[model samples]
Target: MRESRAKSVWLQREPSPAAAARVFCVPHAGCGTGVFRNWPPEHGPVDFLPVELPGRLSRFGETMPATFEELAADMIAGLERYMDVPFAFFGHCWSALLAYEATARLQRAGGPAAARLFVSSQLAPQDGPVGRMLGMDEAELAGELEAMIRDQGGTPHPELVAVYLRVLRADVEMSRRYVVPDPLRLTCPITAIGWSEDSEVRPGQMSGWPACGDTSFEVFAGRHNRFVDAPRELLTTLCAGMAGRGPSRLPVTSR
Candidate 1:
């Protein structure tokens, strides 16, 4: 079942009597749980719960996060419950940085850390956000936003487009202002996913991930926003990590 409390949105739809591991999904900036709306609540034995950040969608009245670190900190308290059992995190694009920081914060607090960290359609946490979205003006950004919405097969009216733009601008600004801190080693594995046709982040740009943990790279078929649709390959990749305890018995982050 899905629950929207003060800090985060837990999008688990399963009412299974017995629970297994869970996968907490974090959306890219300006996006919401709507991205994973079509994904099943249970992928095999694991449950899927997508995290809805504050100030977006149902949390529209909340303040937008100032930094990746700050956002992660805000969500940690609410995320504590899922940690009672084995759980991991899945983040795409901007959420990759947020997830990494959140995982780190969890480790620093000596809390139940995530089983794994799956990052898709993005570069390493140290690589940061780089793209045409960085310098685009209002007109260019508007066009880009419309193109993205249309690519996802949605026809957006001008008024609705403006509403999205307001959030998009703030999200992009956060990305621009972000600076990846010195890398800290984490016990959990880090998987960086790339798309062969993705124009935003390429395979070569996905290096430097080992700074975070024992890292691996996987390539799937699609574009930058592919994860928004929750493709099969992406779900399968995530399900692989969700199945059981990885090489590390307990994941941690070291300063």
Candidate 2:
């Protein structure tokens, strides 16, 4: 029963037997594993695993975590079983904060540390919790959420939008309360990725990541949502980063 419950957070039940490494992808605010449905199963020797946080999708019945720390702890519990092999955590937007917290906590606890932490389109913890979403009113947020749904080629259903609004608001509040004035540096390396046209979190905002550890920065050409498509350049970076070959502090334009 315990094992089954732990597996609930992962969209993939079994780790790839032949994989040399794993990349656990955490969705952005108010989203679920389905965001990664278009991503390839394998990128070279690495397996892509999408995580499903509670209070959304299949885990909709579960209560949302009240704080980032609580959410990190829950993530650790769910991911513990899959950490035996070399693995990395990849998170975009708000989930990047959760990934950082989890990686920091794992190192402090003397647990199996992550090989790398890939934070995309988010400012470092010390620079946050700061984002445009935090300042938006409910009506504005609803409009943004609807826009997102429409962009994804889905018509916004009133009932679904209402449900997602609550989730988004909760996530925004959680992000607002997570101010890490002084962050714990991780033992593992970090790769801070920025989108060239990301209006939400500018590439310059991610410069503080070097203070987190042996950090590298990469800026890919596209908007904030481009990573959702798992573009070839992004996949190449993930695989190379795992093998310790990612470019250092230079932005690479992807065509």
Candidate 3:
């Protein structure tokens, strides 16, 4: 019953039983697994499992997690069964911090530790609560949300935007309240990925990650949201990173 509940609430779909390894993808603030709908189900031996956090999409109306610690605990509980295999966590933007917190806690819990934690376009915890959205007021956040919808070629409905605005505000507040002066160094290595065109988080800002664990940094050529498309280059890097191979430093060509 616990496994059934975890599968229904946390994951978008059942994981690939035959895959050699899995990479659980956590979305950014105010979003759900739909951000990863376009991503391939599997990239060679690695299966991509997009996480579905509460207060969004199918989990809408559920209470949003009040803090990162709560959020991490919930994720760890929901993903316990799936952790039997070699696995990693991939989080983008705000969820990168979530992934880090969960990985740290999971390691200390005497469970299967994550093989790697892949944080994209986010600063290390000690260097944060830093991000443009952290300083934005509700009006500015609403505008930002609208702009994102427009960029995706969708018209933003006022009602939907209003709901997402509340979720966004809560997420932003959670981020603001998260102050990890001295974060726990994880047993797993970290792969910090920076996008060349990401105006929000420059690669230089991610320099503090090495303080957390054995870390490798890679810069891909694309804007902040490009990872949502699950580019081949990014998948290659993740595969190599999980396999304990050194950074490929793949030659950047136009996306």
Candidate 4:
């Protein structure tokens, strides 16, 4: 486990030196490594690394990324020294896009790109915005925010929620304010994961994952933030997928 202020990041690793693949788990905006603290220890096979971005959690003083591209660059640089093993990238929401971008940067930096890219609760870039709250006025945005919480039910701890919400609002501003720098693409395989009830990412839009790489889609019977609502299922799905194996479908029992 290491940290870098240059990139405004913190990270934790549940390492298995003998593991076949290194799994990098990127948290959603306004989230941190604590979100994944319990994950790697319980999952079978593969090492786990949870990233903590600045402007959240303990690193609140560090500058948060203002654009996906910049965040990607920072993550790539931060992880450059650890490219010796086969690795996979898993991210949720804003981090999903970051996973794609970071995979591209790793490739450009002359390393083996992620063996697999797993993205949750987000649409492909060309798919355009879904549930865009940044553009909403304060009152309307609050309603949208509440709807998000109601739909996902992964609202952070109340204290953390207040702080994270403030941070998330800033991140939304950043997302809304970003501009694409180049026509970016990746050759790695991508798997789009989202809830059946998630309006943030449409099924047709998930098919667009092919545009990013060799792609597939898996839907769960939940909402936007499946991790918090369903950790075991999420980890099982991710672990199975990372092993180049098929998913073990869970019954439609909402948590």
Candidate 5:
């Protein structure tokens, strides 16, 4: 993979001539690809590509995507130029859903299909709208953020938290306005990973991933934002699952 920034996309790459696989990661809402900075380097032997959407980090001035379809389309168009290699996708939260749609679209367009899709810390695609947080005014949004921190168990550094809250507001607005244009289904075998304490996503919602495609679901023992809170364990489990077959743990059933 290579580093480039297009209309509304920011791309980062970890190149290796010996790399047998490439993983494209779509970050959670408000998060830049920076979140995966250490992933590629640490989990060697494969190339890692982190995708940056508009309105975050380097692409700060660009308009945030309003709907899921538009976001997926933008990603496909922006990154299709670099699709020569076999690849996979790892996405968190809303990005998981976005990645799923984009991959499905790519297959439909006769583009090369990815080897696997690792969706983490997100509700299943078939779950009813998971309720958006942007409808609240700034004050209400702050309160919601506090509640999220309490429920999710990880708070950014104090200074970082302040900046992230503003970014979070924009993310919420984008997520709130998002509408899916087609059936929320995928043909790829999607592995769904979520936090055990994530109240925002229920067991039923996680189990609904099968409705999206051939899926395997598992719950990590942590809060909603487990990716940030628990890095090594999460990444290792995620990469191992994607690189091989089956989840790190036994498949989960809906509660």
Candidate 6:
């Protein structure tokens, strides 16, 4: 495998070959590593590596995965090169399940194992998906898109929104048809983060995540998209968890 290929695919604000540990983050649907652009400043103990999925953002030239299997395969292939160091996984929304499955795939492939798993604003793999975006028409989706952009602190320009809509529609359709997995339990600890104000996903919905492993739940103050901008609180907890030492308590800002 070409080492440079993984470098281009994963976004690390501070490229640290000397870090003690690494945290590879998986973004939500239609999200890119751009969210972590301002995080983890240089010299952090753990390397903050945010993965950019194919078919979106900088990877627009690649075809998007049509199903969960394809997504997992793509992740396994692309990330196998980075597993030499002690690492953890963090993912949000629908992609959180993707991260879990990818971790399993890594172990199955005789690749590296994650030190920890952090899934936020999403249910466990057994619960399946819970959104109606798949059934919405383009017009309805456009309306939702505009509102979503506004909530994320951005004004959607027509052309840009159109492109975003395309990626979102594909992502939603993929999620809607997804089959929940009978996941493999990990030896590592799992952390489920609930967004206090995120009506889309409640803390109870993610309670099942503990079944995957030795899991803990923490709540942060924010809506569903709060982590998109890479909040300081979120980064701190992730860095600590991936550091692979000391107490593993997460700072909870909410229930």
Question: For residues 167-197, could you state the per-residue lDDT of candidate 5 as single tens digits?
Answer: 7776776565554534446666777787777
Error of 6 at 236 (Å): 2.2
Roughly what TM-score does model 5 have, to 2 decimal places?
0.77
Clashes per model (N, Cα, C within 3 A): 0, 0, 0, 0, 0, 0
lDDT digits (tens) for residues 177-212 of candidate 2: 998989998889999999989998888888888788
Error of 1 at 242 (Å): 2.0
Q: Ranking under TM-score, best-scoring first?
A: 2, 3, 1, 6, 4, 5
Candidate 6 clash pair list:
none
Predict model 2's lDDT versus the native: 0.87
In terms of TM-score, the best-performing candidate is 2
The candidate that achieves the highest lDDT relative to the unseen native structure: 2
Which of candidates 1 and 3 reaches a greater lDDT? 3
Question: Which candidate would rank higher by TM-score, 5 or 6?
Answer: 6
Q: What Cα-based lDDT does every candidate model obtain?
A: 0.74, 0.87, 0.86, 0.67, 0.67, 0.74
lDDT per residue (tens digit) for residues 1-255 in model 3: 434543468887888889888999998987778888778988988889999898999999799889999999998898878877889999999999999999988878887889999999898999989988988999999998898777666789999899999989999999999999898888788888999988988877888887888788889899888897788899998888777884734323323
Task: Name the regions of candidate 5 deviating beyond 4 angstroms.
Answer: 1-9, 37-42, 132-135, 143-167, 179-184, 248-251
Error of 5 at 137 (Å): 2.8
